[model samples]
Target: MKSVTVKNLIDLFKLEVLIGNEHIGRVITRSRAHRPGLEFVGYFDFFPMERVQVLGKKEINYLHKLTEEERNHHIGNIVKYHPPCFVVAANQEGLKYLMKYCEQEGIPLLRTAEPTTEFINKLDMYLIQALAPEMAIHGVCVNVSGIGILLRGKSGIGKSETAHTLIHRGHRLVADDVVTLKKLGPNTLLGTHNESTREFLALRSIGLVNVVRLYGRKAFQEQSRIVLDIELTHWKDQALNNDLELEPKFSDYLDVRIPYIEIQLQPGRDVASLIEAAANNWYLKQQGYSAAEEFMKRLQNE
Candidate 1:
């Protein structure tokens, strides 16, 4: 797993660094945050002290009600575990004790003006994405008709060319040669381009072309939720499956299944147009309309 640090979180959410800059380099592997509700009363059993510790307004106010000696003692016990960081949400008061203990233990102390629930939600989402399982594959991802489609096949199968044509047709290219897919959730996969070559598209005849330069910013997207996988199977001796196409196919990634299909690539085939239709058709199916199923029902009625 690549390193996701406290400093990255600070920069992402614009959190205030109150103390322990040296400890900002701590790695955060846990996606869930720990609120010190139990630890405030000295309950350490089953306490997930390794995750980001968030002290909300209620927790802060509870501590403020305690004596100085008691407050410092409880915070003292909590910070000794040296969690990744202590985030004070809602910019609530009564942080002097927490600051004191965290500074002594060399833990990063962060402050956010956002309310407790909202800030935690944002932080949790970021953590999930940063820590999600990731894989890189050789393909071109594109956003067509509000659907994220991954075009995958062997080299010279026109995956890039189709993506290029789609871009010309007003679709946006996510990645060209290499696309990184992260499992953001059980059913969600985010397809994004590599940072270095995000804007460059490789064509066998024309060489590398900058998508932004050729098609402007609208023609390139940072990331998208991959909803479909189109495998361009070359029409090499393999007969197309007409009957199987009605039920749809599936491809699995990181234990999650995505709607998959095979488009036989023959000479003089308008593969780009087929892909655009595929995107639109998939959207309609999601809205409870399947053309094949509907047509079959009409035949049965007749």
Candidate 2:
């Protein structure tokens, strides 16, 4: 966290300072950051919270009616609160006194041409996300067989449907559609569904449905380690480029490189069976056995 002075803020975002030149040295930063960006836009309304005030043309006009001493007391209370910043919208007429006070206190004064509502709305949106928890991308995630499986697809043939079938097979569901993946540490990547919309699947005929209730609670997982990655793609008659090694290669998603497989989907294909076999195949491979490779070797020997 850091703080920016009024002079710096005036330079950045190029906002005009209508009042308070003395307060140019005030600092601003993240909530806990001792040094804050005075120019920093926050998600919350820091002005009211810090006892800083907003003055538009209307407020300025009303303030003009107060006696000189009353206005001084009001302004004094504001300065005593030690608010780092003050924002004024379209009050150039009343800026002289405010600017003079700001200069003495070293407080930052900000003025914007944009309407008050628009300015606050835009600032809030920017600050909220900037301060929110940060997540890192790892790999796509899917839940299968009570285990979360990360699946990748070029665009869309049947990634969603494959997940649907896995759900119907009594396998618990974790995520659907776009999945957010994060790396927890070395060799461990976590995957989950979109925050706004997860545990839901979209079908061409039926549209969207809740996976948890329709399938069961066991089908939904809040988080899962991305242990395996299966890619669904259009089937090819004969791959011109096949790996001679007949061994699977790994790919990097985020920082983790995961063992991946490409499953080609075609009409009349039992995708569920293929996925299950793929998972089992991976399991067997980890156990130092290859059923498909062994079957090929036996046929060749015959």
Candidate 3:
């Protein structure tokens, strides 16, 4: 099963490890975090014990209000359920029973500098990516003129060449040669670089080029939500749509439908410029303006 370790969280977020050093290696199978508001009041119905537990000012203050016996009883209830860890957000200190009970029960306790909501949001984003279903495809993912575009084609095609042109034209490259895509939710697919070949892009003539070192940080982005997938096909194929308009095209990835298109590659056809135009047109359509639709309407009026 896909899982992330508690140690990974500590290293990823620079969390201060308080107790349960040996338990730091414990695995967290769930992607969401839980704030134990009801659990603190001795209600444990359907509580997700495997998720990371977060305690903030509201929860901490509530626990502090209870008497020693009442507090320990509630804390023991939470600890016995065996949560992955308890993170005290906003850099809180002096968590007496909460700290002691976790240590005694061998549950990992952690602290973070961010506020409750902020830390949870950041942590959840990472968790979703870490645990989400991921697959690597032989394609390039780029941010072309503010739109995320995935270029796909067979080997020796112009994918790399077109991506290099877009990057040289001040657009950002998310990943080259191979892009790892993660399904974030029902409608979101995030594209990112693989750890092995992150900062490099391949050019047939020059081999692998360090894009960031050569073009600086402005040439790369950590990730992008893929909005369009464009497949480059040979001109003579005639099997794909060449003049698709007046309606949208779509394809599925991990059961989620993404806008898809096909661009033909032939002599005298500037595939790079075509890609840029596609990206720009996609952005315009997103803003409720379709150049193709407007042209059709003009023809009807004429």
**What are the per-model C-alpha RMSD values against the true structure?**
2.2, 14.6, 2.1
Candidate 2's displacement at residue 6, Å, is: 28
Question: Residue 27 of model 3: what lDDT?
Answer: 94
Model 1 lowest lDDT segment of ten: 236-245
For all candidates in order, the CA lDDT equals 0.89, 0.62, 0.89
Global local distance difference test of model 2: 0.62
Could you give candidate 2's per-residue lDDT for residues 1-302 as a string of tens digits?
42344455455446775555555555544322111122222223343434234455555665577777766656655654567677776534556666666667767767877665565565444333333332533223555654457777765577777777887887755666667766545676667666766677776668888887787787677777777788877879886355434566676766687887777888898987877876776677778997667877998999
True-vs-predicted CA distance for residue 141, candidate 1, Å: 0.5
- Among residues 3 or more apart in sequence or in different chains, the pairs in candidate 1 whose N, CA or C atoms overlap within 3 Å are none
Q: Which candidate is the best by TM-score?
A: 3
For candidate 3, write residues 1-302 as lDDT tens digits.
78999999999999998888889999998998999998887778889998999999999888878899999898888898889999999988778677799998889999998999999999998899899998889999999877888999998898988888888989998998889989989999989999788878999999999889989999998889999999998887645553537357898888779888888888999888888888888888878997767888999999
Our model 3 lands, by Cα RMSD against the true structure, at: 2.1
Model 2, 4: alpha-carbon shift in Å? 22
